[model samples]
Target: MEGYSEKQLGILLVAERLFADKGFHGTSVRDIAQEADVNIAMISYYFGSKDKLLEAVFRYRMTATKAFIQDLVDNDTMGPLEKIYSLIDRYVNKMLNEQNFQCIMNREQMNREQSPVKDLIWELKREMMGLMEPIVTRAQEEGTFYKDVDVVLLMSSLFGTIHQVVPAKSYIRSSPEFADMPDDEFVEYLKVRVSAHLKKMFKAILTHEF
Candidate 1:
């Protein structure tokens, strides 16, 4: 018999991999059990069911995200652009090392389920948004961003761009132009791109909004 504690981690590891590659509906308990080198009975004994195990994988990613964003926000010395770089850096670095982390999030969202995990997912999103909102609001209020900018819209723009990076990384990495870009180089490019866009938007608003 598999050790109970080891089986739990094993199931999660396999489940996350399968979930990332094939999604929740695509992966099965048997696939996970086989990958983990454990018996299906052990999976049930540890997680009770496949759904529970899947949820745990999602929770793990969100927990890591919370810690990352919190750690960055704790550093007030980081300039707005630096903060953006930090955010992108952490995200890219995480993806480069543990691509499964990002895959799990994107896959879960694709499910579009109305299950109990819905609330947990929403709560996790709220934490990220809350972490981001204050920074944007402060920047706008302090005239770093253009006045009259919509905080919600800005927040969406920032996160939407960053969020797309994960699911599309393979495509980007395969592209000739991006194929040669290392993780740090890619993060810097993102920083430049995001900063340039926001700056242009701010200037446009300054010349047009008022």
Candidate 2:
């Protein structure tokens, strides 16, 4: 988004929504072009092919995420536990706000077809994990968190919970409890609910109480 022109960014945004609504194989170049209101040649000129466009979509969403995590990791003012809480909040807000991109990510990961997009996702996960490890290590070293904490599972639990909840809004709203909330209200409610739940869950998992 930073480097791309207005037209290019517009196409990426359009393609991202289309890819999320329609599966990658189900969405064609013409579909993206039509939705983006550009000629197919523009897509070809900007991204080269459908596969590369898909890759660009992933990169577009993940680039900011990578930078944010890196900044959180490098930040010295926040304590380790505080950083973890902040991380949880950032992810919850991001997933809630960018539900379409998250949907694309979840769908592509489940897809069995091997592609560069899949590889890129894994690569990004690894890099983020690498950035996050130091926070865990810092906490454990300071006796603020337990030594036995599994970073992978900890992240999996955090992300898995968010992933489960974001896509289940319809099911959740069917219940009398959340049935009447407006869409904006529901999302804000989810952000608070999920963030608090995750922070508490992590505190228990990382602290000696467990």
Candidate 3:
């Protein structure tokens, strides 16, 4: 973020949309150039190659989320449950707001290949988990969460539940119940609805009470 100029940032934002829509392999440098209204030379000058640009896109998005989560973890006033709920709020908002980037991430994970970007994705994931692990462990140690709870599976449940709705936006929109809802209202509906559901589920998963 520091090193990038406005033009470079503009290019990356445009590339993010294109790469998300057209898959990294399906999108060409020319496509990015055309969409960003910059010349091919400018793209090469900024990122050197398509692969590098893709990596840059992944880094841009992942780093921001990682930093935000790290901040929540560092807040001393928040208890484990509060921190966990904050994480759920942040995660749900990101998935809904950044649907395109989420799509690209899901694609990359589903179709694994030899790429440096994938490695970066894993690194960011591990970093996020490291931040989350302590909060989760503290909950268990304090008897708020079940002693036998599996952190990884629990985290997966959070992601899995939210992502299932990403691909269903169109179908959901077309349904009679939501057909008249405005896009902004619909998104807020999801944020409130999904966050509440996950919070309830997480509470059930973490607590001993049935």
Candidate 4:
């Protein structure tokens, strides 16, 4: 978001959506250009290639998330547990708001073939895990979180739940309780429900208490 101009930002957003709706390989520079109402040459000039554009999209989304997590890490006011709760809330909000980008990430991760996008995603994941390590360690040292907690698996559980739930809107809507809810209401309802559920689950996991 910082280095990109308004036009570049617009192109990145359009590419994000197209890549999500149509797989990365399926979405071409021309498609992005037409959708963003820019010339193909402009995209070429900005991103160099479709692959680079894909990388830019991932970076554009991840940059903010990384900054937010770093801020939590640096903040002294919030205890580690409180930071974790804040993380849960932030992730829920992120997944809900950036569903399209999440979809692209989920799709790309499933591909076994090696590519720049996959490499970038893995790099980002490791960086994110590194950012969280100290918080988890601090909680353990403080005798608040469980000493035996597995950070990777714990994160997998947290992220996996949101990933599974956020994309299942149609299935969730089919349930009787939410059958009558409007789209706008359902999104807010989901954000509250998911955030509360994750907080409760993590509290138990981290503190060894319900």
Which candidate number would show the highest lDDT if scored against the true structure?
A: 4
Best by TM-score: 4
Write model 3 residue lDDT over 106-174, tens digit each, in one string.
888877666657877788888889988988887778877788888899899999998997787777778
Clashing pairs for predicted structure model 2, backbone only: none
Candidate 1 — which residues are off by over 4 angstroms?
A: 1-7, 95-104, 112-116, 162-210
Write model 1 residue lDDT over 13-79, tens digit each, in one string.
Answer: 7788887788777788999888888888988887888778867776766677777777666777886
lDDT of 3: 0.86
- How much lDDT does candidate 4 score? 0.91
TM-score ranking of the models: 4, 2, 3, 1
RMSD of each: 5.5, 1.4, 1.7, 1.2
- Per-residue alpha-carbon lDDT of model 2 for 57-145, expressed as tens digits? 88888889889888988899988889999999999999999988998898889998876598899999999999999999987898888
Q: Report the poorest 10 consecutive residues by lDDT, candidate 4.
A: 111-120
Q: In model 3, how large is the Cα lDDT of residue 4? A: 80
- Pairs of residues at least 3 apart in sequence or in different chains that clash in candidate 1: none
Worst ten-residue run, lDDT, model 2? Answer: 201-210
TM-score of 3: 0.93
How many times do residue backbones clash in model 3?
Answer: 0
lDDT of 4 by residue, 1-210 (tens): 689999999999999999989988788899999999999999999999999999989999998999999999999999998999999999999999998999898899997776669989989999999998889998899888889899999899989999989768779888999878889899999999999999999888888889
Residue-level error in angstroms, candidate 3, position 18: 1.2
Better of 3 and 4 by lDDT: 4
